[model samples]
Target: MASEHLHAISADWLKSLEVASSTGDSTSFVSHFLSDGWLRDLLCFSWNFRSLSGLDKIHRFLSEVVDGKPRFEHSGLRDFKLDDHTANAPSPFKLPGPQGIEGVQGAFTFTSTKPAALGRGFFRLTQDADGKWKALTLFTDMQDLIGHEESSSDQHGLYEGRKITWEEDVEAKFRAIEADPTVLIVGGGQSGLMSAARLGRLGIRALVVEKNARVGDSWRQRTTFPKYMPKGKLANFLDSYAVDQELCVWLSSSIASTPVYNASSARWTVEVQHGDRKVIIHPKHLVLATGSGSPRIPTWNGMEEFQGALYHSDFHRDAEQSRGKRVVIVGAGNASADICEDFVAHGATEVTMVQRSATCVISSTTAEKIIFKVPFPDGTPIEELDFRYNSMPKAFVLQLQVSGGTEHVKMFDKELHDSLRKVGFRLTWESSPGSGEVGLEGFVFNRQASGTMLDVGCSKLIVEGRVKIKQGQDISHFEKDGITFKDGSKLSADVIVLATGNEPIMKTARGLLGDEITDQLSPPEVLGLDSEGEFNQVYRPSGHPGLWFASGSFEFSRPSSKHLALQILARELGLA
Candidate 1:
């Protein structure tokens, strides 16, 4: 049973409307109704009804009391059956809206039980001067379940045997953005495109700044292609109220019409070169929606002496390049799975996945298909190859040593053995028998023999490490030919792609807002941003009041920019 309360309908009200009332004792129900002063009166008045028949009489009596025509007919006294067909009947009540409020409206819907059975109509709610909420309006017909037959609609239906009412607030904070003029969007993704379409209906100018040369570049850059194209039904459903082209059209229009400052553009200032040159573009009211970058590679010794092609997953754009090559990939994440499939397809001779820890943290479905499963304490199963769990890498370097009285050098690490064993990895240490005038020759192997293994012979090794941002002068010499470690060892590489992650890149936008506003909008440290980091979803810089920051952490499930743009546009146009 649902609990009815002051200015709020109790679950009991919903339960009472069910086909069959619950047999549960009414003690809890009685207590819940009594919990609210107004609900007690309503329930007490309704208590006189012995059953559905009595309920009809009460409905008539209440209709008379309110000076409204009875919309429902009572049948069979005390056992009165409510005409479910009355869903099409007109509502007789209309409550006044609060003073100073205009165009006040609301809507709700009810579900249907029987197949092909029509559902209930929408109902409207409005607020009174005393700051109280009420159902002041309702749909004329309940037969129209979709609520598209009329200008207003509400639904009331039984869900899990309990009646529920979904009421829409007449006053959403973002209603006016649909009617604004000259709206500028910073990022050209789903959020920006959605915002543009909404604004376009209102005759507003919509513009987007996309640093990339093309739209949807982020999705295209992924190593694995989507299994199927998105149906886009959800986007269409949301845009039913507005008259604009498909979401992509709005995005493409914004991208094509807006002057793009790409690598070839003269306006391009920042430049980075490895295999290809990437130029950075500066835009007015910039949006840092570039998303996450590549994973970092850990430093290791003897890495230079391996004489293999080293690469990160981000830098490996094509698997064809690695076909028939020996490959050792580190890390056990989704990217690793994607790369594994790509390597096999591209004809990689053998693939070895080294997981640092005993168990993986992933879902059961993913675990079942994979050859290995590592369970975390939280009941989340991760692919052993997807995440290393608890392993650390130690650096090795080439050096001179006496092997059979000849000078030789190789990588050596006692720390690697200890760390691997601590994480449940089986370690095997082997040393060549010492000869006269020569020291012991040795090598250590931390391998999972039970899991899938790849033959190692002239294979290309791919290493992926955790990503972190390097600040200030720390990254100044990062692009140099050789990497100089803190321990004073140097490693040379044919190619080094800084797979470091991206920061908020808030320099230009922060300058526009000035210091005071940035401080106010800045996020606390817990949200993964530093103390100086600004993480507000709706931020209007002080100096440039109209400029807003729409993208930052909000709910991880849904991107925040879409929600933020709607709210900001609404407020700017006095729609809220």
Candidate 2:
């Protein structure tokens, strides 16, 4: 009901939890939870990502012994309180459980067993069968390491404290990194740079290897970033970020050969090609960060091939090349939509989008206002917001999206969706037809990366008939001047843009690390949810000792980079 009443209930529940936790009473601590409830721990208890479902599992996790000590007992978790600091403080929420049960969801703050670390979390309280309030879900995250906190975002004064000039200092740092980097990053895109930035802030010597000459060169060709940032602008921002963050990067460099990991020494001997020469280096940790691999181009049978130009959308920098030419974009994801709009803008003779399947499209503006505004509002510190957003488990977030949140979004964009349908554009929802998917949110968390399109302006173009839609069947084969569909129909085109997306990151890993290490990766596939509801083969352990994967959008990369860095830090200190 009232915000004050909800806050009071949440406070009471947290107080009980604090008392039980303080005394190290696992049973008493678990008594506050529903039998089937879940506890997702992130670097707070034992420096690893864990999801314990059911009271029994959670109890066992809490009671786990390592080196003759309780895993969570001495975790120094204390001083639990409602996290009123965040935008989404203690408030009323509806759990996506049976009957859409109502509950109180709140952000919380706490201190870890170690004085140098702080923790944050989220908890949902709901009435059980006996009408007694119990936790439906709980999340614990290590917020920051106190003494080793991230560097301030403010620029340093010209004459702060260094004896050497800025250039000299940078050169020295680069030399040190080149000589011996503690962590070697394979790519220099958003994920790689962000991870390097975070690791660098933690005083870790991280060297980024990029085949391109600049940090954001790869992203420059990509049209957009999360939060509606433009491609070119974001690319420049990344370049500036690498410099400002003092991240050491090796440009025009490629991993010359498959890296060899030495288990006994826990190091990798990697040969990197730098320009014309090659340098062999050994680093303790290797971060893939290699993106989603090469462009996924589906080949078709052709007698001699189409005379028209055909290329993957990765190289579709601008539609200037498509001016006065008939363009066919094969896909309905964001890339296709954007490319179609580009063609329309550049005055293509004809712009057609071949939609092979249903796409979940949402208004980008609406999403920014509704979904992002809460956790990522303006005037708030990014670190605080990152913790607040990450405190909620991704599984719980998906559940909410599936239950009614997706419908709320749909309701807001019903007019646009109806307009799209009228134009013969196919659409889908969380529970729509053939499969058990969570719609847009599912594509995000499950890493089905290309199934959703955030409508910026393309939907309007489609509705206004500026962009034509070709729905149904795959192209059977290529025609001299066009492509023939399975339905035996053909559309003439001067240019064919395949917005088919990229292969899974695992494929890249397989080629670079070989099947020996690739096959050992937990879950085998990199994208999609693991048993713990976390993305497989990324951030946390990869079922291998010193290998990690970093993937996802800028939103996920920026925040999760801290988690990934923390795990590496723990290992460096021999704590994990």
For model 2, the superposed segments whose C-alpha errors exceed 4 Å read 1-8, 74-76, 79-105, 114-116, 127-133, 144-162, 224-227, 430-437
Candidate with maximal lDDT: 2
- Expressed as tens digits, the lDDT of each residue in 15-49 for candidate 2 is 99999888888899999999978798888877677
**Which has the greatest TM-score?**
2
Candidate 2 local Cα displacement, residue 48, angstroms: 2.4
Residues 423-472, candidate 1: write the lDDT tens digits: 43332222122412111111111111111112121111222211111111
- Candidate 2 global CA lDDT score: 0.82
lDDT agreement with native, every candidate: 0.31, 0.82
